[model samples]
Target: MIIIHSLRFLIGLALLLVLTLPLQAQEARVTTARVEERVIVETIALNGSVTAPRTAQLSSDVEGRITELPMSLGDRVQAGDRLLSIDAEDVALQVRSADADVGEARAALENARRRLREGNRLGEGRNIASSELSQRETDVAIAEAALERRRAARDRLEVRLERHHLRAPFGGRLTHHDVAIGEWATPGTPLLTLIDLEHLTLEFAVPLDLHHRLDQAELEVRLPAGIDDWLPARPIADVPLEDGASRQFLLRAMLDDPPTMLPGMAVQGRLLLRNGSGPAVPRDALIRRPDGSISVWLAREEDGEWRATERRVTPGASHAGRVAIQQGIEADDRVVLRGNERLEEGQRLILDDE
Candidate 1:
């Protein structure tokens, strides 16, 4: 009976090893990546609308009812393009009155000279008194002063009437329309918003920790895709003041181009840094757990089989698709570049493309 019991126990142990062998030898399905060292950082993508390089709200310098609108909104206007015209009836009447006054003054001055000429001909012995001649001269001077005052007033009104004929400040397209043909556009009323689309700009931000990186390289900004090709870009002058919450700096870059650009366009660009060679991996290579922690899988060679080990990583500056690993991984450690989710510790993998 003892020999039979020992034989059954031995058979049961052999069967257990058969089942465990297949389980231990199972291949791990995973994606592999070459190890590279690169300067990396996580970044915050900022979204903003495009804005005109210069926005001018057209308004009337003199109060008047608009008799005509020569250009409508969205119309391209050149410098000195007439936009609006005010009623010139009152101003024209004033100018005529001023001209009449000048004529009357001229007549009075001529009459005064005639009196003086007659008196001079009579000489000191004549009945004409010197005081009387002086009185006539004074009357002529007074008439001249009155006429000059009227002329000055007329000229001042003429300027206001000229202002009623609005013109474009620069050659550009009109973006807004706040007035109509017969609208009573009073002084300080906005007539339209003009934009010069030739010059474009992009406003973005850089983190405080990574702010020093931008200063290290001659970075060039570019408009993403739709705007235009061959658009030139420039860096910002000063970093924005720190936000107490995020501790970041905002930057505004203007794109100088040949003709001009429109406002509110999508833009994507890279900010070159002084960083040397470093690992640039797909931003998704790192696993972000529900605990709000970031990590990367380090593939270790154990017993001639690839093993994936999770390591916590601190990420730094990021732009486009790649992220920078700040800590937890080394220059030559194999990382599961793609399909790392199915990996388990001590699992075996056959590098598909290897």
Candidate 2:
């Protein structure tokens, strides 16, 4: 009976010792950082194409056989440089004929004026009859009208002669030419294509919602096909019309110091939108759930222990490696940066030393 009592006493002592032992701590080792309010500049990426500011397909104004083509394809020309010359031989001959006619008319006019003066002098002394003087005056008037007609004809021929040579209207590179020496060039026929390469314009399209942000932002352009660096750009204008199908608007800008960028080259543009100050956290702290929601594991002090609490957050633009938290998180909040994927709600946390 004494042995049985001693066994019961030993069992009771063991139970008391187990009940008095402290529970194992449920703690997770994690890296943490304090959320900070920073001035975040968001960027919108857009694809576009590079284009020449001025492009033209030059055509002949007069019909003639091509006599001389001084500027060939891919030739650089300054403004007023002669690109093509049609056969001006016939036109030149016509101008000369007109000039001779003008000279003849002037000589005849002078002879008529001399006769009129002589007749007037004779009439003053009654040596010439009134009818004779009237006839001389009419001859002078006819000669004056003939002279005017000849002068007008000569001017017209000279103007036609000027059209035989096709001159460059602006300084540009000749990109195309179809007319060759001895080829017949008809009026309105395309002769060459000119493009001004000094000034280049980048054409892009963006959504309407970002119009306000783009207006106040700085823009940079990357020509994916030609240039390797991002070039600074200045906004020129936006087309007042919107694309009905895409629901987007067209924008144009001039690239500063562009390098060998040609028309129709594909480009990517970055618009930096300054969105003031906001609470930002490391991108590693963000957790994307299966429900298509984004949340973060925040370290909160609960019952004298730091615990991980999952909070749904509204994320804004991201810059560098950090994300802007627009809502559900505040500045100075401790967020789990590492080991967040294994974190559970209300799980005890042991923050790593910085």
Candidate 3:
């Protein structure tokens, strides 16, 4: 009878222990606040080069030895400013020859008129045929045509001679120099490279896959590292064709205020995705698989265990490393952070400080 009583007491104690162990397990794990909110996701993070709106390679129009170089690289100039002067000795000689020809032609034309008039006045008796008078008139016409031709040639030479002194076509700064004070400049030689940097450009490339996002965009440019504020711009131009290698379309924009922006400086911007609502998550939450697959582990209550389950997520833009969750888990979902290594489908996880 004593043995039977002992067996009964042991069985009761085992039942009590088994009933309390689950509560202990529940106390061991941690819980996080489940908060949900609407998020507007945007796609805009892209890289591009800082550039100018207009660039020109000024060329020499006249062939001559450069006698003066008044402009240097980075020198600001205005329209019609004497950029450089070439020795015009040869051009001047041509001009003089042309002028002399014009004078001789004019004299010949005058003399022919006088001869025709004298013939008509003195030979009125008989020797001067009507045909001879008509011939004289034709000779005068020929002289007049030759004079006009000489005058035209003179004007052309004068225009060429004016080009010997290179002048600025527009207001710009000299960004290069190819001629010295005594260097020979061939016609069409690049003499200077000019750029207008005041109103500058930020030509950026957008991947063709993302072209839809930017195709109708009003751009917003920002350089978080260089500038404190976002710079908005109106769209300017684009390359209709996508780059075969990079599959990106190039674009340009004019800044609202660009007198302060410097050209060729490092800059980055995001094309505004007029659609202003999308979800986002910390970039660190993304788990890149060995095969280059991407996934995330979500902590959830399942089968009475606070465990992590892998979920494949489609990620989008990343701004300052904060990734936009275009398609994946909803907001306020607890994801494994530090304990991702121990994470598995239905594997128990406890946030250290949850």
lDDT (CA) per prediction = 0.70, 0.88, 0.75
Q: Write candidate 1's Cα lDDT for 62-153 as tens digits.
A: 77778988888799988899878877788878778777877877787777778777777765676787788787778768767776876787
Q: Which rank order by TM-score, best down to worst? A: 2, 3, 1
- For candidate 3, lDDT tens digit of each residue in 255-311? 777536556776677765644546666666788988887777778877765776788
Model 3: how far is 82 from its true place, Å?
A: 2.9
| Residue pairs that clash (backbone atoms under 3 angstroms), model 3 | 40-277, 40-278, 41-277, 41-278
TM values, all candidates? 0.58, 0.68, 0.60
The superposed Cα distance between candidate 3 and the true structure at residue 174, in angstroms, equals 0.5
Q: Which ten residues in a row have the lowest lDDT in candidate 1?
A: 40-49
Candidate No. with top TM-score? 2
Model 2, 249: alpha-carbon shift in Å? 2.0
Poorest 10 consecutive residues by lDDT, candidate 2: 18-27
> Model 3 residue 90 lDDT?
83
